[model samples]
Target: MEFGNDCKLIVGVDYGTTSTGVSYALTGSSQCNEVISIQKWPPNCPGLKVPSLVACAGSPGRSLWGFEVRPGMKSFAWTKLLLDPTFNCDSFKVEIREVAGALGILKLPEDRDAEEVVTEFLRHVHQHVCGELKRFLFDTMSPGRVPIEFWMTFPATWSEAVQSKLKRAASEAGFGDKVFTVSEPEAAALAVFRISKDFELNVGDGVLICDCGGGTVDVTSCFITDMNERGVPYFEQLTEETGSNCGGINVDCNLYRLLVTKLGEDFKNLSTTMVGPGSNFMKEFEYIKRDFNGELPYTLTLLGPVPREITLSPGDLRGIFDPVLDRILSLILSQIKRLMQSLERVLSTSKIIFVDGFAGSPYLQIQLKSALRQQMAEVGVLVAPTPERMVACGATVKGLQGIVAQHTNAVDIMA
Candidate 1:
């Protein structure tokens, strides 16, 4: 926390496609990456993430965001992904449009576009975060505006159009001129460096970071050069960023489609219509998908369904997961290969770290490690302990490295 006296606080917001997470820390303190994460919202809900969803009974001002919306509420899912002006709907296996239609949430006035929905959602986030800061950090401050800097994260795979749209939405949502943007993988890497006890970067060391979110997976390989005077680590790009649309949502989509095919249209309509909290198929899949390692074979049983229980064997589950897993593997292998060919000398010490909630799956980490270690035995794979907060915290860390590091250097020079 070698921050400057000029700044009062630094905030990071990971506005993801599936879930949004926020993290903040005071600047100019000696608190080594000590961050406060916005896990629970009003009414005391559990979990460090909030669903990236928004619903309006009428006007955008009346929208309900995140955990505030009930399951039966007419809300939109994956609204952030929808913001991509160039998104190819045909390639996306899951039809978000159809899902919206099925849920009947797209009725007039409430039928808002991606940007509109996101703006409303972030507005709520801004309000909540500001209130929390006021209560905890600024309670004793004099009657004046507190100086705060904001960092928002986005995928490296996104085009400038997508990134600009995000920035615009944030601006509309009340983010001030102090706000800045960072790529998901970059933010995640700094975050890892901060939290990882064994993490150390030397002049020749290499590290690969894979940030797998709901809608996209971004991979970056960094070649560590040297630390700043203040002992802050810095990295140079080793390979071009690799990314894929294959993420946890695709797995969920495939599983859902498979279930629909097996259970028929009747069940499809019924479940999507009245999917109770954590009792539906996708919810059930989430609870177990991370644990399943294709070990001893697997079967996902549809829970809370009336009249009959539906069961899917390991073969079926694998069939659903194979395509998405293949895409992810391809990205990982591509980056590893690129780095190994280029940094053959330090390849032995290189490590791959997966951040973001989707990549937190033990099954995925095991599969990746098994596949990767076979090729490079000395390499290691570690999943971020708190996948949900890694991106947000990483964004915060990015600000620290850039702003605070520079300020500390200037201060030392003056002293």
Candidate 2:
């Protein structure tokens, strides 16, 4: 693969706990505005992201990943959480226990560690991304003809050790030596800042980023420092990121428990017979969870031996969601308090809260807006235009910024 000196390709990979997304831009073109997300994935997964799952249950030395890994297969899920050493802390005890139980029941091969599993999954992602690049750029130039720089995003709360491990995994997965890393919240912020036209951001104004994903929710606050002539906002971190295990998966778990309580003995059979990936029960519930906005009642039908209809009223949905929502709310408020302390003043009316990630639920957004309105009436809560792809897109923006900085530095040196 010969690199072309005149052109370069920048790729961003957002590897979340439940799914992953990819975005890329050709540096020879415009900056962040021209960034494109890779939406085509194998096995016909219809989304901007693919499942972060890998299965090698039956075939040795051959792994199936993403949409290729079908339900009912013994696949590795949520392996991204394994990279965090603090995942076992008291706050995440329930999540840790759940992961352990799933691993034990699935009986994944003992030979592979979490890093290796993640590497395998990422390898598949890299391959698919490369294939897409080739397909798209074939008419102009081979992707190999140009240098490729890869950027990956991780949870903001992750430690240096976890970041290093994730970087190593990405490198091993064929991202090459040019693998760069960015915090998820920062990346999401960049994405929102680049495309946000409605908000008026001035110097020193505070912006809070809430990234709610499948397995965790991370909150970060930053203060705008400068803006370029193009209206791109630049900000500096104002506080250490705070996060928790309360995410969309927890909602699913809550719903499962609710069903068990509601159905009693009937749940036992339903759980054993129909509860798994690709199952109708899981699919229907996922749709309900994604589209539910606090006013709708959802009816879930169970098939197989214990066929029955369970209607979840608005109140029941609220019961399942409020606990998780409350946790996220606490995280945001804590960050806000910290920001206020740092600034040594009350939060200004110009403050903006940007929310992204797959679990940035519609109901969650509504709750955030309502709650923040009551607490800080002038503060606004805005959701990213492409919540699921925000991190990946922001990563490309970061990469583009790096390229621009390098070019400027080279010119300065020559001058």
Candidate 3:
């Protein structure tokens, strides 16, 4: 309804390891309403879950990132895989180097590898947001001065060093010096709480927020106490937990490995087999991996020394993912255990958990919910009302607060 300037615009970028999301909102006197939200996976996507990939194909030094890279998988782009610190797969390493060279950022150190890729992606997003803002506002007003600010979120478990690196990279990515960082779960919680004001959670009320994102599980417990003069609510942290390495990607990897192992038996005699003989193996693998409903089929044909049909029954495929799903469930339970342990030391009360993230994985969600019910018998855990939109919306609200208050103090930061 209302925006900051009706002209001045702010951007929120959730630059995730496995995927990236961008949300734009206007801040003004009435209310800041979200304009658009984009969540992309590796390579570029037109809709939700664009691939976080980068590659190069044309010249030896040419490069590609986001949706531009997916078509040429064998090219120099190694977007999602390169983000992992321990990604030592030889082929992946070679591809990453090629990608880096193509992007003109190969001068970076070996250990500081993925950071550069991420930086470029952030820069790309920055350009996109700026262009969008210009297109939307340039014609309407005689562009005098537009104060542009960017808000990027990271996992709470990110070390101070990582957070610092992200901030510096965001600045380098063309956001200038106006880029700010917030913990992902906190931002989401702020969004959910602001809209659900009638819930009226108290300071003593123990609430757990679980963010089930693509690359991480961010969980935090907080107590909401009051609202600032700007009308944004305040919260105090109680217990925080994260599984930085676990997410939908791991599950995808598991499914890929399973299809390879199960279907490997059919190709044992074949030579020069690439994840099976199909050019579409990688594409199909990506699809099957993220099919949250678990109603998809995995089928492939191999040809070489022996030509045969390889297919997995839904039940057989489910068997492959069972262990991976169980591990995630265990982690969620472990977080609950930690939350209870912390709460016991402080006070005695009923616990309520808020689960969020891109946890549309039917298999994963069922496993997590069952585990949550069993582990915290006395506590209540409900998925946040708008799990997918929580973080982006919350960041917008917090950004508006900062604008209206005209104060950058910590006390006023999320208040």
TM-score of each: 0.85, 0.88, 0.72
The list of candidate 2 runs beyond 4 A from truth reads 1-6, 30-33, 57-61, 95-108, 140-144, 269-273, 344-349, 403-415
lDDT of 3 by residue, 1-415 (tens): 2223444456667666555666766555232465456544333346543345445334322445566653325432224334444444443344334223322222323434566656666666666566556555544444445556677787766666777778787777677765677788787777656654445455556666667776566766666667666454577776665654455544544544554466554433332223411224445654555463556666755434555566767776677567656766666666657766876456432444443445655556555666667865765545565455566655655565565323221111111
Cα misplacement distance, residue 51 of candidate 2 (Å): 1.1
Tell me the TM-score of model 1: 0.85
Task: Give candidate 1 misplaced runs (Cα > 4 Å).
Answer: 1-5, 30-33, 93-111, 138-144, 199-203, 227-232, 275-281, 296-307, 340-349, 403-415
- Backbone collisions counted per model: 0, 0, 23
Q: Indicate the residue-level lDDT of 354 in model 2.
A: 55
- Which model, 2 or 3, shows the larger TM-score? 2
What's the lDDT for all of these models?
A: 0.70, 0.74, 0.55
Ranking by TM-score: 2, 1, 3
* TM-score, candidate number 2: 0.88
Measured with C-alpha atoms, the lDDT of residue 322 in candidate 2 is 90
lDDT at residue 87 of model 2 (Cα atoms): 73
Instruction: Report the lDDT tens digits of candidate 2 across residue range 270-357.
Output: 4322665445676788788888899989998877574778899999999888988888888888888887777765555356555445
The alpha-carbon lDDT assigned to residue 393 of candidate 3 equals 57
| Top-lDDT structure, candidate number | 2
Candidate 3 lDDT at 150 equals: 73
